[model samples]
Target: MSAPRPPAPPAKASGLRRHRALLARLAGGPAPEAVILGDSLAAGWPGPDLEAATGCPTLNLGLPGDRVQTTRWRLAALAAFAIRPRLAVTMVGTNSFADGDGETRVIAGLAALLAALRAAWAPPVIVLATVPWRESPPGRSEADRLALNAALADLADREALLLLDCDAALGPDHAAGLEADRLHLNACGYAALSGALAALVRGA
Candidate 1:
């Protein structure tokens, strides 16, 4: 009989990675006490300005094309990391325009994402932050944007999860600060978001 091949190396556990993915420097100074889980807004595309402003030394897991479903799938990978961040902040629903349904369905998907976040990160507290509203200018409807905000607001009552209003951080008054596409945050807008989060977490 052919010699039995050496037993294959045991498979790695779920959420474990044998290789490294790129990590954008999302915050400043030391390693983060917090982590940011969102789409492009949380990712510093323009630059590392937000990371410097927050002074939290964050790991930006923001995927530019991420949506509710993709976030859920990708978030699982964080489970293997040694760090259990002091805070986990997530912003989803901004890219749900193609959801092909009403707000109810979107809200349900968000809820599931939140649940998975809570279960996976096991952060002492999770901030279920709303996505900063996008500016439609002449092409998009304000009403649709409002609906996205509403879907996020619907999760205010979730236990151990705090609902943060992106409005308070970036509202109509802040509209002038947005980027050209009206979707991503510009320097001023991200500064506001990073500053707002710092204040909240500091007080806590």
Candidate 2:
């Protein structure tokens, strides 16, 4: 068989247009104390919940369907903003798997994103969340997910970033926290995540 197809390139035009207002506000307003970055999971996280959890203004820069590459591009835009967040949380890479990327590429992309984030935001604390469990695509299995998480742990250690295990926060019955599609988190899942994140922010 031919090599698996690569993921579609990010729809930069539409994505940037959609987020233009939010970016402007972020650039114009008082800087947020924390910023969350990722795909749908990060986008859907309630702002009130995050503010309560972190006890500070938090900006969610999540874009649905973003891969690591997409997030890296998105981060470049934030460079124009004079925002200096105290903390930054990232929950990306799952979309990469859905789009047929393997462990090595995903890890490399994540590392690059981290480097870019540091250069752009210079946050005192950076949190790298483990990709949550999800339904495996064809030719992938739970073992692959575990391996990716393990690699993420190594990446976090090497980069001096805190690692949050989303699966552990969701607990052994993680499926209950997942939505019907089994890919994204539901209310219960977000609650768990918010609580865990609060604890981390307090300590950080």
Candidate 3:
């Protein structure tokens, strides 16, 4: 009989490695034409599909467990690189919710992040409203998410940013588009999101 497998590394350790790898890739490669930045959704995005769908060389700067404040902090690292992305897609804020932040704080954090991205890259920013997540997360409610999205939309308008209502793409029934965890997207959901984003990228 085999010995019990070693316990897995702490998630924070694994996340650090992933961040380091992404940074090295960004620092070494050709400048990306488009970038997807935010939280896990940004990290989990099918880069090849997005590139294929949008006809852009894309970079994914998403980090798991990233809140709006975390994204704001990470922006400085991306800005340190010489690259200037023509377009940026952001899908964050859910982690902020999960962190027990109220709607006002989450919106403020998002505003700050958008400000930093604009200052750093001077690109057209596409901000996707926070996606629906499962009840297990235990910090946000459907009503709160909708309110957050509405606030984000208003902010986008004032900031002259493009706000994509991801809920619509995910469909009226949220669970159908989500994975077993009911937080992340399934293939069909991703396809729908990518298709919606392709149109915006073309317009940009």
Query: What are the models' TM-scores?
Result: 0.73, 0.91, 0.88
**CA lDDT of every candidate:** 0.60, 0.83, 0.73
How do the residues 138-164 of candidate 3 rate in per-residue lDDT, one tens digit apiece?
A: 755777777777877877788887766
Give the CA lDDT, 0 to 100, for residue 19 in model 3: 71
Give candidate 2 misplaced runs (Cα > 4 Å).
Answer: 1-9, 12-14
Count: clashes, candidate 1: 2
Clashing pairs in 1: 27-51, 28-57
Candidate 3 stretches greater than 4 Å from native: 1-11
Better of 1 and 2 by lDDT: 2
| Cα lDDT over the full model 3 | 0.73
In model 3, residue pairs whose N, Cα or C atoms come closer than 3 Å (at least 3 residues apart or on different chains), thus clashing, are none
Q: 1 or 3, which is superior by lDDT?
A: 3
Instruction: Pick the winner on lDDT between candidates 2 and 3.
Output: 2
Best lDDT among the predictions, by candidate number: 2
Q: For model 2, what is the error of residue 105's alpha carbon versus the real structure, in angstroms, after optimal superposition?
A: 1.1
Query: For model 2, how does the per-residue alpha-carbon lDDT over 103-179 read when each residue is reduced to its tens digit?
Result: 78888888878887888879989999998889897778899889889988999899998888898889999889889
Model 2 scores worst on lDDT over the 10 consecutive residues at 1-10
Candidate 3 root-mean-square deviation in Å: 8.4
True-structure lDDT of candidate 1: 0.60
